[model samples]
Target: MTNKPDVSVLCFEGHKVRVLQLSGDPWFIAKDVCQALEIVNHRMALKALDHDEKGVNLTYTPGGQQLMRIVSESGFYKLIARSRKASTPNTFAHRFSNWVFREVIPSIRKHGAYGVPWALLHDFTRRSADSVERGSQAGKALVIRKIEKHQLAHEEKHLLDCFQPRLALGGESDAE
Candidate 1:
């Protein structure tokens, strides 16, 4: 039997970032996230992360089972933080960091899974919560409107909302 990957590909601008849901939160493919953050040597970058922050994931592809390197949310943040250290205050890293912090992560948390339509959730999250409410509901963990209502400070909220990770060898996979 073919095991369908429980992976979701989230596109940030032109970059395709693959996320795998495990435990209660999402784990991102290291290379995909590095590409999005413009980190050139992902290997060197991964080394700087804590042992808990990095690891491997087993996934399926047409060829069969594959081992992919993955990173916990904390690892993801470390990678982004590195970029910030290498850039100016208002550089691309800053803006992209904002988007990930404010939009992407929260969207993933609120939806449980991207239970909504794959192609449309991006637009839905981009638009007002009123519009998302108009769509169907499935495993809706949190309303977008509620996040707005709480208006929690970004870093503090996510740190409390998710985990603080011990995460192996990973190989690159197709964007899927």
Candidate 2:
């Protein structure tokens, strides 16, 4: 079994953030954390962490007041997305695929051929879409990967296949 760090909540610059500790387990107050950070909701929390550049800088408004929180899971999740978004999918895929392939896949491996099921993937994909709609480039590649992983053809071909039927119904060629 690979080493899995213990996840917990930590406070940085008055911001309630989650951390992965090597020792004992940690506690989390979802409501308290969200409120302290001044984020509109949990979705906002996910968005902020997803787009962080330098491991998420936690700054305070002079005299060390106010909050900006981030969670460890957010980092892991974003790593998956960043890996997917590079100039070539294969480049990032080789390095970061391990993030998902190592962490998530093993957790639900007991179900056999039907292991993990499509519902979970769908949930992740839906969240990926939400991240993209919220202008999260880190998650944009995740949405693309979600759809690409399921189709037998490449993205452009799949798009053509989808539009072909619509054009045929109107008795018009899709080339237009």
Name the candidate that leads on TM-score. Answer: 1
Stretches of candidate 2 exceeding 4 Å from the true structure: 1-19, 22-47, 50-71, 82-87, 92-95, 102-104, 108-176
C-alpha displacement of 125 in model 2, angstroms?
39
Worst 10 residues of 1 by lDDT: 165-174
Q: Which segments of model 1 are wrong by more than 4 Å? A: 1-5, 61-64, 85-93, 113-176
Q: Which ten residues in a row have the lowest lDDT in candidate 2?
A: 53-62
TM-score of 1: 0.54
Assess the local accuracy of residue 90 in candidate 1 as a C-alpha lDDT between 0 and 100.
61
Residue pairs with backbone atoms closer than 3 Å in model 1 (clashes): 52-165, 52-166, 52-167, 54-167, 55-167, 55-168, 69-170
List model 2 lDDT by residue over 47-133, tens digit each: 655343212223222234223333444444443444323224444334334433564345426521212223344466579888778
In Å, residue 174's CA in model 1 sits off its true spot by 78
* TM-score of model 2 (CA atoms): 0.21
